[model samples]
Target: MARMVFCRKFQQEMEGLDVPPMPGAKGQELFDSVSKQAWQEWLNHQTMLINEKHLNMMDLTARAYLNEQRDKFFAGDAIDSVEGYVPPSE
Candidate 1:
């Protein structure tokens, strides 16, 4: 049987992740509060930001920026968007 959590993002009970997506307290918080679906959504948005910004993960500053954005996103803050990015039309 799948684990269920009261997903903070979806505001409903849904399938939870198999494990914490990260280490430490934040990861525990997510494991406790965020649903797998919501985490996947954040991942998609994160990918867009990385691609559009040409973020270099090797650079500490870039990593820090991404981390900050991730936290803000999960916390429902207005995170910055990829500048000049236009979604493909179906």
Candidate 2:
């Protein structure tokens, strides 16, 4: 299913679905509950991988662009030391 597709019952068509246990819901309370649960689960699984992939792709693209531009920039894998240090005395 598409990431943006909400399994929500209140979509434009309404699908003529009668909301079960209807109360407190604009159209159907049961639709609200079921849709919420399904969408939540869907979002949890889908969002994680898509977000991770986006971050990974962005980092790779940035590194590639930087590499093509200059070899004098910060080292790709170097650890930068923390400065302004004041160690607590024993």
Index of the highest-lDDT prediction: 1
* TM-score for predicted model 1 compared with the true structure: 0.87
The Cα local distance difference test for each model comes to 0.91, 0.36
Worst 10 residues of 2 by lDDT: 71-80
Tens digits of per-residue lDDT, candidate 2, 1-90, equal 311323333343222223342355423533433344443443343344344434353677744543332221111233222244344699
Candidate 1 residue lDDT tens string, 1-90: 999999887789999999999999989999999889999999999999889999998999998998999888877888998899888999
Clashes of 2: 0
Candidate 1 worst ten-residue window by lDDT: 69-78
Tell me the spans in candidate 2 whose CA falls farther than 4 Å from its real position: 1-34, 55-90
Local error of candidate 2 at 16, Å?
13
TM-score of each: 0.87, 0.22
Index of the highest-TM-score prediction: 1
